[model samples]
Target: MIQETLGHLLPELELDPHTVSALLCASAAAVAALNWMQRRRIQKKMEEARRMRDLGLQCMEKAVQRFKQQNPGADPSRILSLPLVELAEKLKEGSLSAESVLYTYVDKALAVTRELNCLRHVIPECEGQLRDLQGQKEKGLLHGVPVSIKDHIGYKGHLSTCGFAPFLGPPEQENSVLVQVLKHQGAIPFAITNVPQSLFNYDCSNAIFGQTLNPWDHRKSPGGSSGGEGALIAAGGSILGFGSDLGGSIRLPSSFCGLCGLKPTVTGAIGPMAQDVGGLALCMRALLGDALFQLDPTVPPIPFNEKLFCASTPLRIGYYETDGYFLLPPCMRRAVRETGELLQEAGHTVSPAVPTSCSEAASLLSPAAAALQGCIVFMVAQDLVDPGLKPQVNCYRIPVLVKKILALLVRPLVSPSSGQLQVFYGSLPTLSPQAYRTEFIAKWKKLQLDVVLCPVLGPAFTLGYPGKLLAAVSSTMLYNVLDFPAGVVPVTTVTEADEEELLHYRGHYDDAWDRRLRKVRAVGLPVAVQCVALPWQEELCLRFMKEVETLACERKKCT
Candidate 1:
């Protein structure tokens, strides 16, 4: 077959065999040289990454080591051991010195950065921030609190690298609005954390920062793009951390690390964009009043409504295990189910609830996947992407002819519903995400539930496994698709019983990805459930999260 095809093509070219052979040889040589250049480029970036990381280590170590030597009696680890709410109280009472609190967290952050590679940079200006707070009788709400910033959010005089190498040159000229607000609240930005390259993948590896490992078990990935924050908080390196979530970035990391995270359905049309913002940022805007709305006039003039947040009425809770896209593992399903039962026991109504239909959404994933890949390629060169992400870039480069071929090959093997992915992937997706959100909102309103509970990326993926487990994010992604406010709370940890149950697990799907779920053996890792409410219902979302957290504490006590 090969000889016949070549025979026809060679004749059409009207070239001698020798000439054709030489042309092929030259093309191969050119390919090899390009490969070498790519390798060299990656090597150079890796060296730069290590050098920058080492410098951050030096700065962190010097401050932390100095604090340890000066005040030997001061418990360096105690600040991290306390809760964020408690940490704020101590600072408010003037019982804890801001300098010492910053020093303690910096000490832990340095250690965590060494072990988990979770920081982009340790805020070098923390000393100046502490000095300014001294002797102030009226400190802000977060007074003396150490907050870890995601790599993408801007801080004055610091680089917002967002895991891109070319984007790593100069420091930012101004603080992002969120940073300004946090500063107003007396919060100190102590350190910046690592993220996946382009802040796209769930896995935390990137050419610039390498990989941010799960603090509990170094073998697994801490869920990302806010992964570094998650890793830091889980390791007791920071009290409160901030991150962004286009999909499930904050929720996934929090769930993976056994922490709390919120993703508000707050619209940028009504929110401040001067800084990278998320759920809590909206709350800040709400609390700070209309002045913030004036600062960013594009934002909705909505302030934090204390009445909505403090309302303690029981919620009608909806829960589900699968979105009919990615079937979760036994452990994750159990976590959601257990949370539903717990919420019911606490006087909230809980029942099985389906999300705004997956049929339309499933068709959107392929286009969504392509667009996600397209954005990366458009912003970065092939060599600049982490080696792990490069393959994805190539796969999404599906040409029209290639897409047709792939559709033909794949359609026969998968379910009729999943086949829509081929059609969506081959075509261009809507540029503005708001169009789809409009449709999802209509369906969600009909469900009439105040809160919903689901898994956060299926029991924290094994290291390097999240990119392959994209569908597992469907449960969380649906909220992003609907622009709903969502919160993640550590409900339980994966137990020996959970691991045993997984060994015999048979999920709703029987495909390659489902088998991977069955094979995962994540014993002793934290498992969390996501709590969600409709758009502009962030106050209700947090309220349920607090209730869920209370129930989690009770479950821990009884166990």
Candidate 2:
């Protein structure tokens, strides 16, 4: 009977009958072994994660306690507004010393890092740099100012892990172009901030540095891949920091953290060094132009212009509250409205502006760009890589047929809407290339408006949730598609009343969007507004951002 049963199943098996039976038994044993190995790997990873989290927490706690101990009666908010630029000016004028300014910011930065997990390294050599700068004949604009850099941006002799384990410890070389520029400007390189693994996800969490909490609300995310810079800047830990944005890396975090950020048009600001991969230096020099050269030499030689930003009169402002894909959260809506009112009141001609079709533009642009580059995939792969299981290597090593079969069998278990898969499929030749070209040209022409204001995402969702709904990122990426400059400014905080209002929201968009927006309302998250400008419009972007900032400030006064 057993032989008959085996014979009947033989056609269904891949190997010879005897071999198939032995292999089946062995496979069971192997699966058991694999499961055991997976559990062990998971356990180890969890422990490591826990340890890193705890270390970060403890450090923050101690630093905060120290700050309180030092300034028993001081208001934390007062410390938050201590302007680095002003402090540097004072230091240059001989009214303040570099040592005092460095100490104040260093002490405050230490407190912030402990509380927010915003820092990866704090330089003890900050004092040495300050002392060296004190003797300089001509103090630059940032002289004696302490500045922090995101971990991914290189600093000489510092670790440029970009928050990955393989690149941990100190790097062999000195400053990247940006770092060199900052040093040339007389800024003291005091610390390096944390970043998400691979700098992909919006939430600033990783295996190396763990998660960075929002200074405004610890439960909420600070935003990423430049989240650490945002958090540190928001908390007044740094006056200026370097951040890069492919999607919304700079803008999202800045908006979420209630700080100002600029995402220059490609080649606007400089110095992401050419990285050597597999003994080949991948040079991005062709992509570098005037836009990036203004910031660093590692970038092309673009000169900074102060005149383009100086508007002689009130400017024409184009604004929109929602992107049409996702409804703006109440706080964000209010911010846009308030900004319009302020711009109008400030003598600017504020008008309602609508792009032709945000949905079509986003759908056409993002998936193709994201997938072809594997930009977000490698960014998060390090965090997802199982230390013990060797999942990445195993996936690579498996036979193609076996891999396809396994994927087919297992895909049902995973969510169809996962961004990882979406990004993966985005690399395929399935998208109509002509459609992309036509849409890109159309979107570019439609974006002739001076600057656009829109929501970062519908409502203020938590950190982890944004990963799945990355398509909503089109609000920001719409500009990246057009190679435009964009900025993010914090407008308002979520309240119970807003939640009550969102509870009744029934939008005309898809059910997935409705669900995501509803989930966002459940959490009292901060609302942020985004401003977009045409290509090579960093000056205009900053000006529009300042206008919004003024409006936000006025609203605060009114309240």
Question: Tens digit of lDDT per residue, candidate 1, span 122-202?
Answer: 888888888888856677767877787888788887778767776767879998877777776778888888889888788
TM-score of each: 0.87, 0.74
lDDT of 2 by residue, 223-285 (tens): 877878878877778766767887778777776776667776772232111001100000121
Clash pairs, candidate 2, are: 60-114, 60-115, 156-174, 156-175, 198-379, 267-291, 267-292, 268-291, 268-292
What TM value does model 2 have? 0.74
Judging by lDDT against the true structure, name the best candidate: 1
Minimal lDDT window, size 10, model 2: 274-283
